[model samples]
Target chain A: EAGVAQSPRYKIIEKRQSVAFWCNPISGHATLYWYQQILGQGPKLLIQFQNNGVVDDSQLPKDRFSAERLKGVDSTLKIQPAKLEDSAVYLCASSLVGGSEQYFGPGTRLTVT
Target chain B: QQPVQSPQAVILREGEDAVINCSSSKALYSVHWYRQKHGEAPVFLMILLKGGEQKGHEKISASFNEKKQQSSLYLTASQLSYSGTYFCGTEGAGSYQLTFGKGTKLSVIP
Candidate 1:
């Protein structure tokens, strides 16, 4: 079985520029999540979607970050006017249902200079 | 909120054993473990559900104590492959988010 897939494995952009990351979850998974992992730190939950409807985004930086899972299969996470601190690995994961072990993607490494 | 992990870092010789703990203030319904190599996405290790159940792969085990709202990852007779940063992600009751602990870096020297 194929695992979670993500595109643009590495990215480099200047501060104040816009960047977007894409993710394709595992087949048949219903819950998708976006997480930001900084250097030397664990991935921090940014948003979660249950069948295209957000289940939790309390930690998302609304002013600069946005994500959507259209049709509940593929998802995109965008950051406009990126800041230096936004330079981190953006990971996408998916699970079976309400509670299950998540499968992670290779992650898109964003470098905001 | 993020969970707290103990022994921020540990160094072990081959064939030794080590334990990493993760504690959360909020009641957890499930605890997930992952091992990440430097610059790579974390790989799923195991998940321990509530009711004090333990589940894991060969040589790597974990225990979840619902009463204590904590979980521990155990690596027995460690090998070089066990060297990496270990993180515990916990899902609280009624919440979909899986808050992760900072991490525990383990170095197993041969």
Candidate 2:
């Protein structure tokens, strides 16, 4: 079975620049999530989607970050006007409905200089 | 809120036993554990559901105490391959997304 897939395993951008990351979740998975992991820390939920609609984004930085799941199959997370602190890994994960385990992608390591 | 993990780091010799704890202020419906090596994605270890019971997977087992909203991961006869960061992701009783703890860094030495 294929796991969640993400694009651009690594990205480098300057402060004030914008960056986008993509994710293609495991087929038939009904839930998708985006998380940010700063160095030496655990993953923090940035947003969650149930199919094509967002279920939770309360922790997302509204002014600078946004995410969307299209057609309930793929998702994208964007960070605009990146900051030095944004130099962390962006992880994507997916799971079956009501399932306890989540499959994670390789993640995109974004370095904002 | 993110769960809290105790003993930010632990170093143990191979064959020794170590324990990592994860506690949350909110009521937890489930607790999921994972291990991630440097520069790698987290690999699922085990999941403890409600009922406040203990679940064992391989040489690693976990206990969930609903009354205290805490979970603990036990590594017995630790192996050199056990070196990595362990994270506990908790699903609150009323929440959908899993909120992960800071993590416990474990280093099993030879």
Candidate 3:
């Protein structure tokens, strides 16, 4: 079976610029998630989608970050006015269901200068 | 809240044994383990629920202690492929959100 897929394995943007990352989860997966991993740290949950609806996004910075999974199969995460602190890897994962094992994508490494 | 992992890093020769521990301050519903190589996505290891059941994958096994809100990963007779950063993700009671630990770096050499 194919695993989660993501685009632009690497990205570079200037501070205050906008950037977007894409994710296509495993087929038939019901739950999707977005996470941010800073250097030397574990991935932090940014948002979660259960099908086409969002289940959790409490940790996400609404002022700058946003994500959506319109069809429940693919999702996108966007960051506007990116800050230097936003330089990190953006990972996308999917699970058969909530609270189940998650399979992660290769991730998009964003470098904000 | 984020979980705490111990022995931030460890080095071992092949055929050795090592243990990585993870503890959470809040009540836990489940604990998930994953290993990630440099610049790679994390690979799922195993999940231990609140029942305190122990799960194993190959030479790697894990145990979850509900009473103590802690989990430990045991790697016995380690191989070179075992070298990576291990993370423990925890979910609180009645919640599905997983908060992860800083990670434990394990290096196995021949």
Candidate 4:
């Protein structure tokens, strides 16, 4: 079976510019999540969605970051007015349920100069 | 809060044993174990829920001590394939977010 798919494996943007990443989860998966992994650090949850509804996004930077899971099959995460600190890998994952193991995509490595 | 992982890195000889520990400040609802090889996505190892006993997946065994809010990953007779970074993600009480540890890098030399 195909695993989770993400677009634009790598991205480079300037500070104050905007960037967006996309994800196509595994077939039939019901839960999707977005995470940020800074260099040499473990991934931190940014947001989570169960189908078309968001399940959690408490850690996301509401002032600059936003995400949506439209139609429950694909999702997008956007960051506006990017900061230098936003230069990290954006990972996308999906699972059958909130309690199940997640399958991750290749991730979009964003470099904000 | 983020979990604390012990021995930021470890180097083990093939067939040797190793243990990685994770401790949390807040109460944990469940602890999940994942292993990620360099440049690859993390693969799930096991999960130990609150009030649940120790759990084992293949040769990789994990124990969740709710009283201490700590969990440990045990690799017995380690193999070269065990080389990777191991991260422990804790599901905090009443929270859906998974606060992951900094991760422990394990290098198993054959």
Write one digit per residue (lDDT tens) for candidate 3, span B1-110: 89999999999999999999999999999999999999899999999999999999689999999999999999999999999999999999878889999999999998
What DockQ would you assign to candidate 2? 0.76
Which scores higher on DockQ, 2 or 4? Answer: 2
Each model's C-alpha lDDT? 0.93, 0.92, 0.96, 0.93
First chain TM-score in every candidate? 0.98, 0.97, 0.99, 0.99
Candidate 3 docks at the CAPRI level of high
Clashes of each: 0, 0, 0, 0
Report the number of the highest-TM-score candidate.
3
Local error of candidate 3 at B98, Å? 0.8
- lDDT per residue for candidate 4 within B23-67, as digits (tens), equals 999888999999999988888888899995799867789999999
- B-chain TM-score, candidate 3: 0.98
Q: Model 2: per-residue lDDT, tens digit, B4-110?
A: 99889999999999999999998889999999999999999999988987988678999999999999999999999999999999997767788889999999999
Worst 10 residues of 3 chain A by lDDT: A66-75
Checking candidate 4 for backbone clashes, the offending pairs are none
How does model 3 fare in lDDT? 0.96
DockQ of each: 0.81, 0.76, 0.94, 0.69
Model 4 TM-score (2 dp): 0.96
